[model samples]
Target chain A: MATAAYRDIAIHLGVDAGSELPAQLGYAAALAAGCEAHLCGLFNRPCLPMIRHYIPPEVIERHKAECERAAVKARQLFDAAAQAEGIATEWYDMPGSALETVLVQARASDLLLLSGVVPGDKTARDYDRETLADEVVLALGRPILLLPGAPKPGLPKTILIGWNGSREAARAVHDAMPLLQRATQVTILCVDPEGQRGLPGAELARHLSRQDVAAELLVHAGRDRDAGSILLQTAQDRKADLLVMGAYGHGRIRETVLGGATAYMLGKMELPVLFSH
Target chain B: MSYRDIVVHLTLDPRNAARIQLAIGMARRFGARVSGLYTVPPPNVPYYMGEYIPTELIQKQMDEAQTASVSAHTEFMATCASAGIEHRWLSSELAPVEALRLTVRASDIAIVGQPDPNPADPASVPYGTDVLPHELALQAGRPVLAVPHSGSVTEIGRRILVAWNGKREATRALHDAMPLLRSAESVHLVTVGPERKGRTLLAEITEHMQRHGLRLETAIVDPAGQKVGMALMAEAQARQADMVVMGAFGHSRLREMVFGGVTETILSSMSLPVLLSN
Candidate 1:
């Protein structure tokens, strides 16, 4: 998911321009330095109703020029960022609806970085970025990094992981490998430890040890403590800057029946979280 | 934080009155406000030759029903006032999904009921039928505490299971659950794997927990020839864990269900309530 944020949506779409570009570039650079970064840029020609309608030729020309200008500026910013990041970059420009373009790109990208659409933006006529982001999360079935303002400065030093033995957690670990490798200290806290095994915990510690990361594993065994509350406490105790984990584990069915830790954490945690599904 | 200002979402089903009363008692314990929500299907429209008939009267009736619904809801809220719990009524024109999203955003936590049995197949049962909790978890980005529709709210969180893995997700979950852990009676750290690396990870986890002033015990499961999920389930059941907290396990959408080993296993097999953080 982080990869897509840096490569496709942020870099290619040039949504990182203005205040957001520098931090986005920095994150991309950090990633490239640590791992093999895949850079994908998406170009979407929005099927604007105004453009599709049989309007006067003059009006069509005017709208075309405006869009072209925006495109050119975005291109310049992206090129500069990509050049500085020193990563291989690819661009996908398709003629379709904006939503389709995003979905297609998101399907391929690791992380999706989306620029929130202002409710009353004059330039974009119909698209609602927030709703679109949510839809993309549901449709493309990937995690999304919604950059409300500029990206947070610096790579995360302290990372709080909401661990459950679910596949989402495993995917989150893989997704966070690059960052975890660079973090100063990684803490793995088990909220309900009454019967948790020591082997898997040791394996994870061993993995981090090989990566040369200073890691700690902690178990919080308590009765009646839900996973979400335990995770929040651990994050607070460690002063973690970023939390990384999987997205929703159970679907509509499992969630409705058993409840989900991810849902609880999202609602409670205030820190920045990197989620991958 | 003080437990005052609780927001409860109650179903309007008459049979659920007992459940509503139980929820109100919980709210009173926390000194919170209660909100009753009823989810109804959007009014239907008849189709004409090409376009749907615009039934103005039907629209008016729908509007009036909504108003009456809110009024009835307000009466329920008044009951809260008598009990010293603040209350309010809310009606939305949006669908249940959107309305629930809005409710989660507006409140701290949402309380919802469990699903009912399917009428067509009486033997078949439903679990969490309301989409609100999961949607709120995913989209509203809030923590939701779900109560059984029939049971009473007991002491919140007594025996918690931290599905420990040395993964980023597990670590985050542990941290997220610290507040409750500090007050827990006993915490048992369980790891399912070989003992070699397990010892070191156990030491690290033990040290971390010690700092938090939580007494910890460690358990190691070999899983041997069995899959990780089966082993974990056996261990959890053996311990009689009320809740199992673990990191969500999956990848891309398609690969998540088909290729994912641990997630599929847990989703299909878990007998106990599992807390999954993705």
Candidate 2:
């Protein structure tokens, strides 16, 4: 049987550094408890621009104090949540660049959980939320579960996988095996532009069958409609709690030069999305 | 994961029977259905050379290939029947590597044989037979078990030694081998390198395994100037492991070919059955 479990899960806590437990943490803890995994909370010090000399000393001191306080609060909240969930836990205070430090620390993690919500506060000053998520998704070499803006009450029971017969798509499907095996229902969505194959998703469905996942296949015509829109519409229509798809891109370029569906989903995802590059 | 769809590639080599028996044993253990794949060699003569060759000679070659394919199929079916497991047969005219690549995606694992170091009749060996297993391991996106041609491997996965390094390929291979690891009588995660780095990586992986209800016997070997592949094989033999599991092609293929990588060393010098995934 496929191992429907993750042994190590790490959550990004740098953005939600307030004195409260973020929903992603609670969700991560619950998942850890379900699989007996060790949950690690990774919080990196806030990144400030190098123009510190031009800034006032008092402002710098105030920012430093706030960051120190946030770190302590985040640790306490993380510990309490883990205790509440009753799973093994670890806390790390990363003291370097945000993305690099998190990557170095979470190298061995099976899943890295990050919030998809970028703070809308105009006055907020911290790491660049837009690029951080993209960088991690591309460079982590592990699966990333991007949480919705609002937390769902429980874990995902229904999963919709986007398959396009590409290497990235194949990797995403395989990496999402643990979740797919546990989902109550799985629907494989294949957007065949040419509609050449007699049955679009039969091969992948057969492959999943060997792993004991009975999935329904949904094939759609690409006639004039963009793939990203088609996927998003299907996901919404089906009320899928989770979307599993490949985070497609090369280097620092976004979907403009590469995968349009990935960019669309990343920007407008209403449900939790699991992405593997 | 437990493999339910198992594929064994059959050729005309003498070690073909041993490979079939190994697949049957595995199917019996995992409750899997075996599929015997026999790929017929395409016409040796190119289109340009076709006009120069005699039609009678071409017909004779085609007849011989058909005879070989039928005999191999018969033997595979008989072996599966006596073993009392579900089985299927697939014959393709595609090249051996391409056929296995397409067929293995739908299957859980592939059972292939190591190339014979010296063939009794080189002419009889099909084209691309020697490099089939190695190429499949790198490009097939599935775990492949290559049975050594020299020895009779009656028991596998009983005692497994995993060659570990904290790299992406190794992590993938370890996860793909979980089904076998869970059932093994004993498993050892062996790493050979600097002491501190090895110990830390082993500790993390050991903890991960512990969560899966497996207690791994850990080892950090001192290479002492020995090559990584040789060191790992020596340790597996010393520990009496029946099987070896490791990643394939950690470096780029071109770089490995030029600089001599660990994966090449193991593939050429392997004595026991090796499970490899990339």
Candidate 3:
């Protein structure tokens, strides 16, 4: 059988997905260099709606021009940075309807590097930032390597995977394979889990082992703490470079909307997150 | 890593023939043992009809299912013989999905079909029903390659597309996809939207794909800021690629499934199969 590894990677650029361009762009470039793969930057520009018939043509032209400026600006910045790193890179930029474009591109990308948001931030739009992250994750059908502002740079030396025996979590574990195998240590953290499936984390651990990922399974009580908070705490305590887990929301997974653990993690993530749905 | 053992769900539908062919092809490629987990569901009887249900009718129905099971087992053996691969058969009277789940060891990668959830389809099998592939992937503790029931694919992973991002999940998926890519004629690595500007991830991906001897080319597309999912689908179609390979979701299926976004869009609309690791 032929062995495989990543050949491509994508990063979200623009004020919409990530405002801190240098940190993420620098990070993505370094990642592309690490993998020795070509890099592609999509400079997306957020635009105001421009299809109104009653609006003056000049007004529409002005709006279009404004959006184009943003695209040009983002592209120029991306180009300069990509070139400085001496990386083979491509650039894509457009105005308005960026979310849809990004999502569609996600279909083709293996991993999407997105900017994580701090929880309780005003709506990224009319919606919550975490929910928006969910939309990106669901829409992309790709693993998301999410980085917060001022991301702690470099590959994850220590990783934490939140295990709950859900399909999403399983996907996350499998998706996180490349990083997990590379990491010096991996901890399977199960928080307040009922352990519904027999040998809950063992099989997953074995699966990782087969990939040469030495993992330790740790079950935490999660006493008086939400699963989201507990997971964050564990990641911080472990000094993990990456956190892997499934994004959960809606009735599609379980009945309780309750706390919206996945959403919380996306909003206030402390470390880079590798999420698989 | 190689999949040493593969378990393919065996049912009595016309599609099982194609499924078996694909599984056998994989077995041959990987030189792995293929186990046909044949399942026969008990006749559908009411939930709590104690004495009201007629015994003879139920018995007759059960006998028919058992007969079908025997036929399936025979087919499996024949197919295995023709393929000249190491094989085994394990048939059960338990509900097909549950039975396979129970019989399957955690280490074995499962091969199954994604039957149309619509009950109206003429080709649909009663015993082997919808969402079997998803359930197996979740329960089997192993990767599940889901072939849609509506179409047939004789070979898989020949000319492939690696939808890559530098995330660990994508990284993991790339590793899982290696066995298929190693033999592939071409591997296209692509990313959408803006570039991550992360050099380490891209460099590593190039080195790894090259090491496998895959004819690899990486590109970035401007979907002109279109819905990323549509952009991705268009790219896949444009290439005439056999399948699109990538990690499944970066979030839980619960919220994303409800919103009915990109992953769902691809699952429903993809003309080719998708190799999803996460």
Candidate 4:
């Protein structure tokens, strides 16, 4: 619960003037609302490249004007959402890659809100929706809440932690603790866990007790089913609202495969998954 | 970090109460508003068979759906009222999965019970989706907390087994699980390897855990020609790790295929809870 309290939150607003902009803005508003936080809408205006010697000034100026117009529009949108939510808000219009912009801005921010980059949809500052997660998460060194392309406004209530027993998973749980503690219910779901070391659920339950985050372990003897599918299946079966799990649990190459859990879940997740990797 | 709106997909299953109670507890914890959503299916009558169904049978189908809807709403309201959480109720004539999917908004998280594939005591309007959670997680664009059909869930994030890979996902999973580890009764960190740069990697992780104050000892398992996933499961079983934290495989498409085999192996053969982050 203290996660968003008294912090600087940055939201990435891309320039493509597409649908993703609102979702990012909306989520930022929701996160900053009533949290006593400064919500900055970091708008990546697609201005002309700094190489003015190669291009004519008139053309560059035209692009600059267009980009600035978009930035104004984006700021207006962000301001409206923030005002509606009664949160303190600011806007920054910068020209450059959205990914690079976020990486720089997030260094001073406690949290970053980003919209899922839709493949082929031209976003502001040439933001690549598909690769944003990997590029930003790896370099930002901050927590980024990725909103599904069309996100609805609300914090996750019930949560499913994809407990795979990886250092990555551990980090996710650590960063997500504040949010996990605030949830009404959380589940530790294991799909065909490689539990040669211990009984899977018992120890985790005891550990959660210390945090007052009562949790139960559910093991799926996955038979001819992928872990990602089973995880989402079990989550839906339980009617969970949120998924908390570590990202990239397998060899890096597997993520390229469609059957891989990380790839599958990221591409086809029906829920708001808080992935940290 | 607080849940403002929480939605529960109410089914006609008997275990609905358990899921509801869990959601109620979550709402109370974060001071969130609860929304009870139910998707009542039409009766599987002679209509699907393309047979001339009797009027009485058709009437019965409608009646059954109505009754199930009313009952689910009542229960949801009662639970929210008792828990003293703000609440709302929404239902649709659509398929159960579809209803739950539409209910998901960026700011809202949904709680739904898995469709009972084989309901020992099926409700008047029975439904099942062994794949609902998966579908929802993909389509809802929100987080869906899935409780098992058989277990009674109270909380999560305790007694965790962290599968360390010294990779991006592994590092992410560890940090994500930090809050849980900080409050855990015990924490176990394990790395499966064949001694390739082992000592340095192990030491690095050890130092990281020490910095974070995680007390569990780390186990570097030598697969001994066994698959890394198998080795991890064996270690998890021995440790009774209720939860396993590891990174999901989403690095390179080519590597995805090669790595998919191992991650796929764990996904298919898991025997305990594993937290996968990507």
Question: Whose TM-score is greatest here?
Answer: 2
User: Model 3, residue B133: displacement in angstroms?
Assistant: 5.8
Candidate 4 chain B: 10-residue stretch with minimal lDDT = B116-125
Lowest lDDT block of 10, candidate 3 chain A: A249-258
Q: What level of docking quality does candidate 2 show?
A: acceptable
Error of model 2, residue A131, in angstroms: 5.4
lDDT tens per residue, model 4, A10-53: 77776565656666577668766634467877888654555745
By DockQ: ranked, best first: 2, 3, 4, 1
- Model 2 residue runs over 4 Å out of place are A1-3, A15-21, A45-67, A96-109, A117-142, A166-168, A223-226, A247-258, A261-266, B45-51, B117-125, B195-198, B250-260
True contacts kept of 1: 0.00
Descending-lDDT candidate ranking: 2, 3, 4, 1
Q: Note the Cα lDDT for every prediction shown.
A: 0.52, 0.75, 0.65, 0.61
Q: Assess candidate 1 and give its lDDT.
A: 0.52
How far does residue B211 in candidate 2 sit from its true spot (Å)? 0.6
The DockQ assigned to candidate 2 is 0.37
Question: What's the TM-score of every candidate structure?
Answer: 0.39, 0.85, 0.64, 0.46
Residue B33 local lDDT, model 2: 88
Best by DockQ: 2
Model 1 quality (TM-score): 0.39
iRMSD, per candidate, in listed order: 17.9, 3.0, 7.5, 12.5
State the displacement of the C-alpha of residue A84, model 4, in Å, after optimal TM-score superposition.
1.0
Retained native contacts per candidate, as fractions? 0.00, 0.23, 0.08, 0.05
**Strongest candidate by lDDT:** 2
The digit string of per-residue lDDT tens for model 4 on B1-278 reads 33455677776566678778877876776566677777776666643557677888868878976887788788888878987878888777676657775445322356665444354544433554444554554344344555555566666545778877655445545654554576677887788875453334565455445544567677888888888878887888788776566655544687567444555566556644444444
What lDDT tens digits, residue by residue, belong to model 2 across residues A1-277? 4455777888887744432246666777887786568998888887656684587778779878877888887877778779888888888786767787666555467788876542343224323554676788765657788764545535578889987764456557777777788788899988887878577678789878777899999998894246667777888888888888777665432343224555545435547778876
Off by over 4 Å in 3: A1-4, A16-19, A50-73, A80-85, A119-132, A221-225, A249-269, B1-5, B10-28, B31-40, B43-94, B98-109, B113-126, B129-278
